[model samples]
Target chain A: MTEVTLSNVVKRYGKQQAVHGIDLDIQDGEFLVLVGPSGCGKSTTLRMIAGLEDISDGEISIGNRVVNDLPPRERNISMVFQNYALYPHMTVRENLGFTLQIAKQPEAQITRAVNEAAGILGLDELMDRKPAELSGGQRQRVAMGRAIVRQPDVFLFDEPLSNLDAKLRTQMRVEIKKLHQRVGNTIIYVTHDQVEAMTLADRIVLMRDGHIVQVGTPLELFNTPVNTFAATFIGSPPMNLADGVVSDAGTIVLRDSLTIPVPKSARAHVKPGQKVQLGFRADNLMPVGHAVEEKGELVDLELTVALTEPLGTETLLFADLAGLEVQAKMLNPRPVQPGEKLAFHLMLDKTHVFDAASGVALRG
Target chain B: MRRRIPEWFVLLLPAFIVIAAVVLIPLIFSLYSSFTPYKLTRPSTLWRWIGTANYEKILTDVKFWSAFGRTILFLTIALNVELLLGLLIALMVNKVTWGQRTLRTILMFPMMFSPILVGFQFKFIFNDNIGLVNNALQSLGVSNAALPWLVDGNLAMFSIIFAEVWMSTSVFAILILAGLFAIPQDPLEAAKVDGCTPWQTFRHITLPFLMPFIFIAMTIRSLDVARAYDIVQIMTGGGPAGRTELLWTLMSRTGYVDARMGLANAMGYVSILLSIAFTVYFFKKLSAARAELGMGG
Candidate 1:
């Protein structure tokens, strides 16, 4: 029942605006992640919901209660900050029990709640030690235990895993996902890493500047990005895009040399002689004989390999198509030297077309 | 071997001579004088070694003991009140978003005044006649009588303690303010999200973090307040019947006005013990506070 909703939420600092009016609806028990580059207002949005930052001109409600003027404690929400923010002077037991203690619960009740959280987070042996005595990962677990002891309706995480190393971050990501599954509480997490957003989010809210670019599940945003920004921002090496023009014969003119039939999904959205950009990920474009058969119409091209990155099982081949650099994947990786010619197949079904001038997706 | 001076002692000779001349000699001289029946007016009495006589007399004197007790009481009350007031001021100033620097500078104004000047300022303000406190009270119709602020035993003591606090509270404030600034904002924010009320946050997160700073201020001010002489002397000169007399005033009066250098030196030695005790006690508390903050003391 702890569904969080933000309608036209805006944040302004004096003369400048940090977050424009944005609408969001977070479902109960759903793990939603707000993600973007630095200064994209994703953190600001989360803080506003957590009641740490004030919303300049919008209504925010938790469980049907308009909490615009209510204090954080009254909102029944717990937050884990980027830095663990453990009480340095207190032991892990005290840190975990603090919220309940503050609520004036009986000492016995607080101890019970603390012990439960400790057991859940595997903090039993470390209970007597202060935050300074704990390692980064241990401190992070204490912070989560502190947040859980309150048993709040919703949990808010602001780049909580950003401080950990790459290996630790991956480990904590699994811990967080497992924690969410066990707790079944509505969680709103924020991070700048797209991999985190893709892996952990039931829904990802991609933000840029002060606006939300798009909101969808990981597969939806990956398979169908709204525009060039989404296409380029989601995948690791980024989706390869080439500038081209629409032809009168249901084909695309690329660099004035090669002509490929337009992707069927975008045929209705483009008119003859219109400017457009062709977008496809490395996964969709594969070298022949190394790739499985794609049911979608495949356009074959013999492109010169510029470079190849061998990633253990698969090799990423960088090839030139009409003087434009594009990435293609080779599943059954074999060493290919630079300037070596290789035949590649572009899966038209997965390929996306965009209005070049507007950078808007042409798919219906 | 005895005929030859060791190279290590030779290397240290210059430093030893300098320290002995500057610091050790004066300390030894004072200790010697405290044991002798020395009088400043008669240099001939300097050689008279009357061991334990001065200490025995001063220890038995009712006035000396009273002044010693008064100094301790003054230190206790003034230090505690100043600590509490300074913490309040620092917390309030930390909340100011803009013009905080300007406010902090202004907060230090009281500390800039010399203790003597502060004593005079408060003496006049608390005067029964032609003073600010009395005048304001009379005009406001709060009282019709001119209360003897510097004559009554309790009021005179209050006036001097008030003066000391006015001149020194800013030390506590500035230190605590620095503590406030140094405290990471993360814990405070965490406290807020953890359902702590403002008071609870301050009592738990803010105050515990400020403990080391508070103890540091106490350690410094304990030494400063123990030797409170200038302000007490200027305002009361150890009386209106010796009501506001303290250890410093009693010692200075015995040595200078009464010319009993030996007895005064004996009193000074005793008071030095008090200062040392306070310092050691505060240092212990400071280290304990640092330990609680998980900083290895």
Candidate 2:
């Protein structure tokens, strides 16, 4: 196992730069995931680490050795592509043994390694079948098995579970986590799915337009995003944002007469008549019956219920808060009809306030 | 109720009649005449049933057997050489990033020329004294003696093989290039990540994927080369004491110039066996390669 460091890494295709100079230090045996939307250069960064794509500028070191000039084989890295790129002509046994054969290992050793990988992946019975004969999940396992048998210093996964169905993707995510724990190799996985990043990464690097917006644990990003993009991008159902202006009394004034007092934590960042964006997650806005007395500010608002989505244990309520559509969660919710006004309390401690023009967060 | 003829059969009757007149009748007539000593000059000789006399003579003829062996040698050399050269050209062309379309179009130039025209072109280039090769060699101080390219047995065979390969190697290159394009990029990357060198990746991944395409090109070129008529006829005409006589050249002289149609018909039937054997062999190899790639059987 080895640590991978990218110092000012940048990638360019012709004149258009896909990845700006971004620095990341991945610890040995750490599962770091690079997550972003499409065109966010997350996959490009992974490919650069794999040596599949050349870096336009800066140095990439694996195990503290500069590998910019080395080919992929010399770098001692194994990559699992988004599409499970198993050799179509080879059976699972051969696919797992390919790297060992190329390295000229002994026949007995190669067989032992292949068998061990097969056992790890529960692929012993399917070892004789070609990739085309395997199901999608089986192919994914074989792809991972091929990487596992190599015993490389670093394992690179380029959205390896994207092609599987939703249920299978979740299953494979667990398997990947278990494999990482068992093998303890440094892994850099790239995915557009936030849930995958949240579930699988030890530290998640969120990027936008080739720039890293945040680098933190999943809860850190969920609790405190540095900007509006991270706040919404990391959470499912996204953070609800509304335009507001700071009143002369250090309160946020919404559409007409609606107002909320700024939390003491962000009071210093606001000024009179300063335009700002108010952000809060759906779960923080509790309905009246479920509201609890918390240490932070609790402001009650009479919101007209626009819609409700029952999700077994709780219901997601879409309501209009002072002319702004906002989503709130109701625990122990009874059936509430549309156009009904309900009192909902805003958990100001959990709410985020951003500069309207710059989208920068105001909380400490 | 009266039974009615199928409308599809009625619609196809014209094609059937045309095929019978143009294809079926000639095939049957040739099979029938192969048993007779039918001479073009003596029409009545067509009725004389020889009953495998021509076949027996051809089976025993040293000249005919030599031509048959030479034809096989020529086909084997041309197909293998063309495939190798075509693979080289295709690999080089596939690497070109800029002006690839123009290069692809230029690669087809040799195939556009007629075989007979190519024959004349090589014939003059290999002429004993005044040829371009001889003049260039002498002027460059490489040799003082005139090289008899069309006279010596080996040189004559080499010249013919060169012309054939030059004209047809592009067929393999074009088809294999198409196969190269059809290959997905993921497997190649996977091979690289699996620690394969460039050459190993090519041997293990790229070439296996192109095997079916290469065999297809070989099947087509083999049939075309086994007939080996126009180029040899124009370049050497089975001359220099029959040193480079292919089966088609020998059979043509026997049939048309010698007017012994019965003997020529026998030779034609025997040569057809070569084409069928090559076609079957290539097809089997193609299917095996496809199966190894996990395609349909």
Candidate 3:
């Protein structure tokens, strides 16, 4: 087991910087995922840690040793590429045993390690087959097998499941989680899919445009995002943001005829007549007929339904709320049509208020 | 009911007629002439079938056998040296990120010249009295005597081989460079992570992937080199005492200069065996390499 630390690590491609200075501490045996949209420096950060890309400045240490100048082989790391970079000429057995052979291990030891990895990945029948003979899932498994046989200090996955279909990706996700539990190595996975980050990351590092926007547990980021980008990016269907100005009576004036009382928890973060953004998730805003916990202060709004999406047990209602398009959930199974008017309640405790100019969360 | 010919056959009739007139007729005529005692000056001798006489004569001719052996030796050395130099040039050119396109275009300059021109260029360069090589050696005090480049046995052979290699090595380079470009970057990175040194990665991954392309280049070059005439004729003329005599030069002398058409056709048929042998061998190797890379036959 090893702990990986990135201390102000930076990556610059000539005049264009891909990864700005970012610091992170991954505990021993931790499954840290670096995630963001494309060009967000998430993959670049993982590549630097893998020694595939050079760190322009600062230090990256694994097991308390600085590896800034180390080559990928000397860094004692194994990476799984998105395309499942198995040696097309080698059989599954040879692919697994390649690292040991490179290290000049004994034949018996190499064979044993190969067999063990094969057993772990359920590749016993495919030992004699080349990578082209295997299915996408099987090839991905062999890629992991190749990495695990090295038994390196760290495992780096650069969008390894992005090539698989949806069903296989989910299956491989669980298998990777199980592999981490079994092997207990320090793993860093990078992906643009927020769902994968939420499901698989022990601690997620959210990045945006060469900067680390936030780092926290999945639920923490879901419950308390640092800014509007994090708030919308972390959740599916995203959080609905509406422009508003706090009125003299501690109410937010969203439009000419619509005004809402400022959430009590955000009162200290804003002043009267201050411009702010009102944020709420689909789960927190629901139709009046739907059953909610009712623990927080609730406010009602009359919105016209623009669309409805029936998703099995519950339905998603797309409605125009206070001159802003918002998604609200309907717990009760009912048909919703366009132009239909409905009253929905906003759960104030679950909502967020942000500064209009900077997009920073207004937390008291 | 009346039977009718197919429309496709009618459409292909013109091509078949042209091929028969230009290719099939000459091929059959040569094969028939190889069994006769025909001379260019005596047209009546073409109908006299002297079966197996020319073949038997060629089988026992020591001079012809020596020329055949020399042609084989020339092809082997030229092909091998070209392959090695070509691989090196391809690797070096593949590494250049800037001006790579310009460098590739420049690399094809030698290939653009005709083999006859290349032979003449080398012929002057290797000339004993006023040649650039001898002049440079004498000026640099490296050699006092003029080297007999085209007269001596080994020197004549070396001069011809040098010209052949210089003119054709770029074929291998271009094809192998295409192979290098087709290699995926993922496996190289994976090899790096799997603890393979640069050399190990190249040996295990890069070379294996390039085998098919290499063999293809080898096959084409072998066929081209087997018909080695224009360069050898211009540079050495198979000369002083037939020291650099190859099959094509010897055959041309026998066929055209001496006007013994039937004997030359026999020699031609024999030399065609060499080309076929090399082609078959290289094709077998190509298919084997492709199969090893999991590309099905």
Q: How do the candidates score on chain B by TM-score? A: 0.95, 0.97, 0.97
* Ranking of all candidate structures by their TM-score, best first: 2, 3, 1
In candidate 1, the residue pairs with backbone N, CA or C atoms under 3 Å apart (3 or more residues apart, or in different chains) clash, namely none
TM-score of 2: 0.97
Residue lDDT tens for model 3, A297-363:
8898788999999997888889998677899888966888799998888898888999999999998
Q: For all candidates, what are the clash counts?
A: 0, 0, 0
What is the C-alpha lDDT profile of model 2 across A117-194, one tens digit per residue? Answer: 999999999999999899999999999999999999999999999999999999999999999999999999999999
| CA-based DockQ, model 3 | 0.81
Query: Proportion of native contacts found in each model?
Result: 0.85, 0.77, 0.77
Indicate the residue-level lDDT of A338 in model 2: 94
The DockQ figures for the candidates are 0.77, 0.81, 0.81
TM-score of each: 0.94, 0.97, 0.97
Encode model 2's per-residue lDDT on B27-54: one tens digit a residue: 9999889999989999898999989999
Candidate 1, A270-334: lDDT as tens digits: 99999999999998889988886666799999999999999978899999989899998899798
